[model samples]
Target: MSGCYIHIPFCAQKCSYCDFHFSTNHSYQNEMVEALCTELKIRSESWKDEEFQTIYFGGGTPSVLTSGQLQKLIGQVKSGYRVSNQVEITLECNPDDCSTENLTTWKKLGVNRLSIGIQSFNDEQLKWMNRSHSAADGLNAVRNAKQTGFDELSLDLMYGLPNMTAEEWKSQLLQVIALNPEHISAYCLTVEQRTALSKWVKEGKLTVSSNEQQSEQFELLVSTLKEAGYEQYEISNFARNEHYSKHNTAYWQGVKYLGIGPSAHGYNGKERYWNQANNKAYMTALKQGNLPETIEILSSFDRFNETLMIGLRTKWGVSKLQLFEDISPDKEWFKIVKDYEDQQLLIETPESIVLTEAGRLLADGIAAELFIIN
Candidate 1:
């Protein structure tokens, strides 16, 4: 099913490692909300007939918005789109943003799931990440979300930090497990270029974790979560009782979704669309009743590579029949697949191809090797 994503480009404070589009300034929030609704309306003209089962509020910090701002945005979606009765609406929030009052308001606003950006429960790491919340705030957010009737909870964590230890990672995972969230997403910390993280690394002030350490932590994460009854449904996500993130799952499976607000992206089966990364430019164009976006048409070559890139990172894997239908694999490509299967890194079925546990650690490298370079 199709989905709609709203990017809130406002954050209280910038995380040290974040490279996503956002502004710390709140002077234009009202204007931003209006612009977002406008874009939603403009894009809905062609997609209004499609039934949407997921609506995700992602961003700089969706929790930064007030009840009125949120009401306006969700109201716009309800007015313009064909949302299904079983639609799952998720809001990305920071721990400090959660309160009984705020949680109640969010629930009334049609937000059924809360993807809280806990990041870590360690106070020092929280400060290091420039996170606005304390460890206590993270704990309170989860307790508060459950108390407010948000059963579909997803908490985010970061592992493989610079100088992180195996014991430390295990402690963090246990903290999350104790919280008993319906879904948990753990990400390996990467120093993306142009962020404070990269600057520190370049100056030799910080040492990023070695690939070997990260792999060890990843394996630990998989086994620990599995013992706790959570399924590693996707590479970075774990869910209990099959409660996967509908929007993300659909996105990975190549479902079409309309993205609202600056720096958001939209994709259909054949093409990809991304909005202006500049907030002012995005809002200005929307005010002028235009879409500030670039669209790329996908070729068979492009589609085939993309299928393997994303499809191999999941539990369901990619359909072998569908992959061949997209483009014929060359002799070399087949041999690479054979080598991986022989090593038990890949499992090739007549119908599909999936990564084994050992294969997941090398997921990116393997997928890259299988990529049809232009």
Candidate 2:
């Protein structure tokens, strides 16, 4: 099934480690809403026959938008595209934005899922990350979401902070478990270039976590979540009762999705396109009835490599027969797979080949090694 992603590129404050396309300007909210709805209308013509199974509002902060703004955008999608009755609508919210009133409003608007960005419940860490929410606010948000009756709830956590000890990481995980969220996404803290965190590291103002520490924390995360009856469906995501992020899962499985708004990416199986990152340019183009984007037609090699990279990261590995058919007659590739299997890094079943627990640590490396360089 296909999905639709709406990018909200406005945030109250930029996170220290975030490098995603976002602006702290709230003045352009109304204009952005108009442009987004217009873009959705323009793109919906191609998908008139298609029905979306999931609708995700991802962003700098989707919660930053008012209920009216959100409704207008959702209304556009309802009128312009065919959405399934069981569509999973998700909105990414920060803890501070999860007020009872806001939660009730979103629930009424049919937002079935809420992915709260509670990076850390520790006050110091929250401050370090430049998040607006306090530790109390994070806990209160979860309680409020649960009380508001969201169909599914997910919490985002980060580990491998330079100053976070093993015990502290454990505390964070336990706190999340206590909240009883349906899904949990734990990510390693990586300092991307051009981000405040990266600059701090380069200036010797902040220390970054070592690879060894990150690895240990990752192992801890998997074991702790597994013990809590959560399935590690993806490398960084854990879910209970099969309540996985259908939108993200579909993306990994090569399902086509329409991306709305600036800096958004869309894939249509054969070709991928991304909108211009600049908000002004995006709005101007939409006003002029043009799509401000670049498209790339995927070659066979590109498709194969992407399949391997994305497929191997999930609990569902690449289909053995399909992989063989796609990259058949390549003895070298077969040899590489054999070597990995022999090393116990990959487990081969009759239907598919999945990574072992140890292999997961080197997932990126393994995918890279198996890439079909053209």
TM-score of 2: 0.98
For candidate 1, write residues 172-228 as lDDT tens digits: 999999999999999999889899989999999889899899989999999999999
Which candidate number maximizes lDDT? 1
Clashing pairs in 1: none
Residues 185-239 of candidate 2 have per-residue lDDT tens digits of 9999999999999989999988988998899899999999999999998999999
Candidate 1 matches the true fold with a TM-score of 0.98
Q: Which stretch of 10 consecutive residues in model 2 shows the poorest summed lDDT?
A: 320-329
How close is each model in CA RMSD to the real structure?
A: 1.1, 1.1
Score each candidate by Cα lDDT. 0.92, 0.92
For each candidate in turn, the TM-score is: 0.98, 0.98
Clashes of 1: 0
